[model samples]
Target: MFAASVAVLLGAWNNVVITRLPGYPQSYVPVNLAATGLLLAGARFAGTTWQELGLERRRARAGIGWGGVCAAVVAAGYAVALAVPAVRPLLADARLAGAGSGEIAHQALVRIPLGTVVWEEVAFRGVLLAALLRLLPPRTAVAVSAALFGIWHIRPTLSAARANTLADGGAGLFAVVLLGCAVTAAAGVLFAWLRLRSGSLLAPVLLHLATNSLGALAAAAAHRPG
Candidate 1:
């Protein structure tokens, strides 16, 4: 069951990257939802409970509260970035530029949370982390899951960085990919820590949503005609 679960997860993930299916930035909704369902099923079959999956109802309130605070902080940070000329580039990712207002709204409201956040929180912080904890120590589980989460971003990183023309030759692109992966891996560790601290996936989900969704909105604002 463990091996099957791993294979299924990896297969689904690879397919998403390889296919660039239906289309991206939004196409991932069904793909992630399906992968999430399969992972949950495999996890349950292997004796992992919903609470172990980081859906603990008792912790939900605390998680949501903490998450909301963090989300607000992120929003304020983005607001400041938008206000400042120097730091605005931090919010204005070139790869996400040129989007229409409707497209930006869809990305922030629908695609980001549903396509990106939901399944990711459930899969990494929820399923994989719980499964690993059953077999390994808690720290080791977090490390391994965080590492995998980082690796998961490699392809997407390559695609986005290329779109932004962030690097030049092959070696430069390789360097960019390495740097991107390293950053995401670090972020994964932080997200994992938040999951461990809150004991409910809501905390990380809201944080992730705010980070991506707000950034998308900020990028659109930055690129808007002035």
Candidate 2:
């Protein structure tokens, strides 16, 4: 939880600054290094091998298949809901403006280097999940991880939306924040489940990559004026 919190905080800070700053913060490099170092350090201290963490080399297909399936589900779910009138309003609201800017910003955000994604999955789902699995029951570890994931996003996302509202008051923007959080929470849970089932962080990382890449692609496609 502590590591995840730090990662999220770093990401949030990076998100806030990237817009105004001339150069994007090279966050992924440091985050990946730190996460990998920390995990290895922990394993060394615990007198355990990589295989113990269930990170032993497995059939490549297992990772790809599991991750791909989960990613497909999440992406398909979001895409199918595009036609839902209620969903559109909740996602954009007055604060978010049209989908164009949102998509552009989202694409920029997800381009945080694939290495960072691997580190995050390893740290959050691999090392952390393994620790929690031993300390708590399987179900409890999954729930706690999911909950943490949700909480991690809340601060940055809500802060961004609220800042927009404060700069230019948007009526009922808080409702949009609430709705977005709920949707992300659902995603978090599903991602956690993928992590648990695949028995490797690779699954969640691939799923994340797929979702992010698709989102960015879709957002770019939507940026064009009809």
| Candidate with best TM-score | 1
In order, the Cα lDDT scores of the candidates are 0.80, 0.58
For residue 9, give model 2's deviation from the true position in Å: 9.3
lDDT of 2 by residue, 45-157 (tens): 76545643547677345767898887888688656645465553333333233546655564436433344465556656666666667668878776766665555555556
lDDT of 1 by residue, 1-226 (tens): 5834673565358435536667654457777777678878888898888788888789999789888988999999989888888777656667667777787888899878887898888888888888888888988888888778777888878987887888999999999988988887788888888888888899899999999999888887887542
Could you tell me which residue pairs clash in candidate 1?
none
Count steric clashes of candidate 1.
Answer: 0
Error of 1 at 219 (Å): 1.1
TM-score of each: 0.90, 0.65
Stretch of 10 with least lDDT, candidate 1: 3-12
